[model samples]
Target: MEYMKNYKHWLANVKEEERAELVALASDEKELKERFALPLAFGTAGMRGTLGLGTFRMNEYTVARATQGLADYIKEQGKDAMERGVVISYDTRRMSYEFAMKAARVLAANGVNAYLFENVRPVPICSFAVGYLGTFSGIMITASHNPKEYNGYKVYGSDGAQLSPEATARVVSFIEKRDYFGVPEATVDPSRENVMGKDNVKLCDHITVMGKSVDEAYFDRIAKLSLSPEAVAKEGGNLKIVYTPLHGSGYKPVTEILSRMQIPYNVVPEQAEPDPEFPTVKMPNPEMPDALTLGIKLAETLGSDVVIGTDPDADRMGVAVRTNKGEFVLLTGNQTGVLLMDYILRRHKEKGTLPQNAAVVKTIVTTSLAEKVAASYGAACYDVLTGFKFIGEKIDLFQKTGAHTFLFGYEESYGYLAGTHAKDKDAVVSTMLFAEMVCYYKSVGVSLYDRLQEIYKTLGYYAEKTISVYFKGLDGMEIMANKTKALRKVDIREIAGWKVASTVDFLAGEKTYSSGKKEKIDFPKSDVMKYFLEGGDWVAIRPSGTEPKLKLYVSASATTAEKAAEKAAALLDQMKGYVE
Candidate 1:
């Protein structure tokens, strides 16, 4: 009844065109309830959902309401915050540009300056612009790697990181008080040509359209992050690469960076341009193997040794390298993270640029091999919760205290950041670094695959597998919560014949050992569980923060790759049994 009431309210308030869409759904009870049973959740990462006319879907009204709440929060910070403005950027998703303009206009209506981009941009650049332009905050209109039906809103602090939990909570409090239809409309039409930055156009009082200058500064900063320019100079011309943006926002920037670095690369023409439909791929996510099929085929045609794919927002990257047998194999996120870490550290050490306080950060679900690699180079590795924001927070902390120099940060989901220029995972920089890495390895007569094998031989084989079980429909959230709750109550002693040495309940912020000793986990409480086995193996179970699924991650290490793979597979299978 409440959902029905909300649906009717939305249908009545929306425009004639939007009302038609809702009217069509009136007869579909399931669809109506799915779209109105709850308001699209606005967490620290912001909200994401289907594009439709409902309380739970993303639309002009929803974007406007969220922006109004953000404006209120900025107003709390005072007039200076209003003058500082907020950077706004979007990808090529359907209505992405419209949603971005809507947010900009809403912020402008609330008397907050909105520095909207002239055209589409990726997440990293938006994050970078917050700090680069001295903005009070930043907003990115993207769903990252989600399907085409979904779009999202991400808020960033002045530090260029996603808002902290406390900050997000404050913003949400203001957001909850606002009525979607009551938010004030834009006082001015800033979308006109005269409002743009080009042709010496005079910007409006509350809105500024940003262009090339921000990108130039961002590219310049990324160029300074190249550790092996000489290697790139030597092998760049010969080491051909195939890149595919998967019809998202990565095409221009990814190509421009490779050209700047003088790296020889080919782009899959079918996916070289921005298409909101993402026609060439089922999902615009690089983490999915099918997304790279075009890129890999082009690689084979061009005799390229590497294929790189960036997601819809270009915040995450995935790679497939040619092996010794002349076969292309996709590298898992864990493998890519470790390889990049090893390459960065080794190069820095060779050039004597490696800081004595160098450090790397990875999510708790990431491969433990990073620790072994970091230690081999006399660097420290730290684990954080499963978000790039935690990594960004650490980068901010390192800058304040001088405790450690942040070298690199990554999660197990193909997101990576190498430079402090952008506080979020940057596929632009990651693409640049990986291209340079391939060149660097080629200069030493080693393929990327061979180097990976060598690292395994030295550090011992490490295998990691991640599996997600979906829970669709309105009951998805409730089911996932109940499943995690049930798991928390069970004392899992062993999994796949591996003894559980300890179990960590992150929601309770406690790690209980088999010896009956309990230690507090010095991290924020989250609905997550991690088990440490007899060996250096680990398995983590947690509900996905952004999607309707429970994710299980397992990592197993052994003297050989086969054994490690087998162990990891078994552990993952057994872990699934516990949840399902």
Candidate 2:
């Protein structure tokens, strides 16, 4: 009844063209309820949903409401915040550009200055622009590797990181106080094209359309992150790489960095351009091997041994390397993170530039092998909660305390960041560094795959696997919560014949040992649980922040690769039963 009332209200207020869709849904009670049952959730990562005419959908009205809430929060921060403004960028998603312009208009309506990008840009550049322009905040309109039917809005603080939970809560509070229809309307017309490039063109008094200068500055800063110039100079030309953007926004920046480094690469022509439909892949996620099929095929034809794919927003990167048997295998995010960390540390040490307090950061779900690798080089490895925002927070802390030098940070979900140039995962920098990494290994008479094997052989084999279970529909959130609660109540003392040495309840913020000792976890409370096995392997279960899914991660280390893989597989299978 409430949903129907809300639906009627929207139907009455919206434009005549928008009313037809709402009126059509009148006969389908289920569809109407699904659309109007609740407002699209604005979480720590901001909002994401299918594009449609509904309270729970991503539309002009919802984008405006979210921006209005953000604008109100900025106003509370005072005149400096209003003067500082917000930087807006979008990916090549359906409605991405329109949503971006709508947000900029809403900000301008609220008297907040908006730095709007002239064209499509990726996530890292948007994050970089927030800091580069000293904006009060930033907004990126992208779903970041989700299906083409979906789009999202992500907010970043002036620190260039995703908004913290506390800040997000404040924004959500303001969002709840406003009615969807009552939010301020756009004050400026966004119809004019390429206004950002024109010298005298201003969309409004509060809007500034940004152009290539921000991009060049970003490129220049990340270019300096190159660690192995000599190796790149030697092998960059010979080491051919095949790259696919998967019809996302990565085409330009990824290729630009490679060209600047003189790394030889061929783009997968089919996926080289931006297409909102993302026609070539079922989903635009690089983490999925199917998305890289075109890239691998192109690599084979070009006699290239390495293939790289970046997601829709270009914040995450996926890599596949040729093996000794001349077969290309996709590298897991854990493997890539470990390999990159090892390469970075080894090079830093070789050049005598490795900081005495050097540190590497990883999500608790990431491979434990990173700690071993960091320890080998006398660097410390710190574990944070599941989000990159925590990693960014740690970087800020390290900068203030001078306790540790941040060298690299990564997660097991194909996201990585090596430099602080951007406070988030950067596929652009990752691509550049990985290309150089491939060259560096080649110069040493080894391939990326070969080097990965060598690292395993030297440091002990490590294997990791992640399983995600989707919970769809209206009851999805409740179901996920009940499942997590059920798991917490169960006494999971042993998993796959491995005794649980400790159980860490991140929500409880405590770790209970088998010996009856309990220790407080130094991180914020979250709905996650981890089990430390007696053999040093571990398992973690956490609900995804941005999507309606529960993820189970298993990590195993053994003296041999096969054994480690077998152990991880067994653990995952057993853990699957618990969640079910």
Candidate 3:
């Protein structure tokens, strides 16, 4: 009944095109109900949803409401905070720029200065700008790697990381206090004046359009993160790397860095430009095989040794390398993480810059091979929750307490970060590092794939597979919730014939042993469950905090490669069966 009222409200006030779409949706009860039944949920990662005309969808109304809430929170921090303002950037998704400007306008209306990027930029740049400009907060309008019809609004703190849960909760509380339709809307007249000396200063009174000054500052810091500059200088001209931005925001920064480093590289021309429709790929995500098809084809044509693809906002990256067998093979996020981990450590040790307190951070679901590689070099490894915010949090914590020195951090979802230049996962930094990595290995007469095999040979062979089951519509949410709840009640002694060593419930913050003993897990509480099996293998299940899906991750390690792959596959199948 309330949704019916909300439907009428939108039908009366929305744009002509949106009004027509709403009228059509009204005829379909299921779709109408799904769109109007609830407001889009906001969490630590902010909000993501399909773009359309409803409270449940990502439209100007929803974006405006979120921006107003953030503005209100900023205003509450007092006049100085309001003056410091918020930085805003967007990727190349439909309405991304429009939504970003709308947010800037809202903040401007509230007497808060807004720093808006002149054009689309990667997420890490926005993060860096937050700290660089000493802004109160930052906003990024992107759906990340999602399909074309989707867009999202992510908020970042002054520390240049995604807002922590407590801060997000406060923002959500502010959001809930405001009416979606009643949020004030304002306007901004953007100009492209080349203010060289004042590139990042406010132009029209309240909103500033940032220019090359910010980019140069960000690039300078990213350049310092390179572990092997000599190797890059020696082999850069012969690296033969191919990169694709997937029609998003990575093109400029990614290409700029590659060229500046003097690395021989080619861009997949088809996806080099910014296209909100993402015409070349079904999904702009590099994690998918099809997303890299065009780039891989270009690499093959040019006899390139490696291919790299960045997602829409350039926060995540995917890679493929030419093998010694004269074939190209894709590397999973886990493989790439460990390869980089091993390389970073090896190079640091060789250079005598390897810190005695060096430590790497990864999510629990990531490959355990990183831990092995870290241990081999006497570097500590820490596992955090799934999001890169936790990794950023660890970085901040390490800086505060000096308990451990943060070296590198990554998640299994193609997100990686190095150095404190940017708090979030930075594909630009990762892309440059991978090029240097490739060039270094090539100088030694080996491909990245061969180096990966060598890593497996040195450490135990590790294989990991992540599967996601999407549950759509209203019923889907309930189904996912019930399944996770039921799974928490399960006390399985074995999975796919492997004996269980223990079960760790992140939600309860406890690990239960087969003998009925329980010990508290030191990590933060999350809606995740992990089953540790014999031989150091494990499986984890968690509902996606940002998407309408349940994710299952299975990681296995064995003395032999074939056995590890087999065990991982079997564990994944068994976990899928349980969820179904």
**C-alpha lDDT of residue 249 in model 2:** 89
Cα-lDDT of candidate 2: 0.90
The local distance difference test score of each candidate is: 0.91, 0.90, 0.89
Model 2 RMSD in angstroms: 1.3
Candidate 1: clashing pairs of residues: none
Number of clashes found in candidate 2: 0
Model 2 misplaced regions, further than 4 Å: 189-193, 196-201
In candidate 1, where is summed lDDT lowest over 10 consecutive residues?
A: 193-202
Task: Quote the lDDT for 367 in model 3.
Answer: 84
Which TM-score value belongs to model 2?
0.98
Per-residue alpha-carbon lDDT of model 1 for 1-580, expressed as tens digits? 9999998888778888777888889799999889898888999899998887788888888898899999999999999999998999999999998888788878888889988888889999999999999999999999988888999999999999999989899999999899889787565544574433452132566878888889999999999999999999999988889999888888889999999998888999999888988998888988888999998888988888899999989999999998899999999999999999999999999999999999999999999999999999999999999999999999999999999999999998999999799999999999999999998888888889999999999989999999899998889889999999999889899999999999999999999999989999899898899999987799999998977899999999999999999999999998998888
Candidate 3 residue-wise lDDT, 1-580, digit = tens: 9788888988887878767788788678888788888899998889999998888999999998999889989988899989999999999899988898889888888899899888888899999999999998999998999889899999999899999888888899899898766666545343533333456666566888887989999999889888888888899987788899999899999999999999878889888888898898888887898989998898889998889999989999999987778788888999988888888888899999999999999999998888888999999999999999999999999999998878899999999988898899999999999999988887888778888888888888998999999987677888898999999878899999999999999999999998889999899999999999977789999998867689999999888989999999999998898887
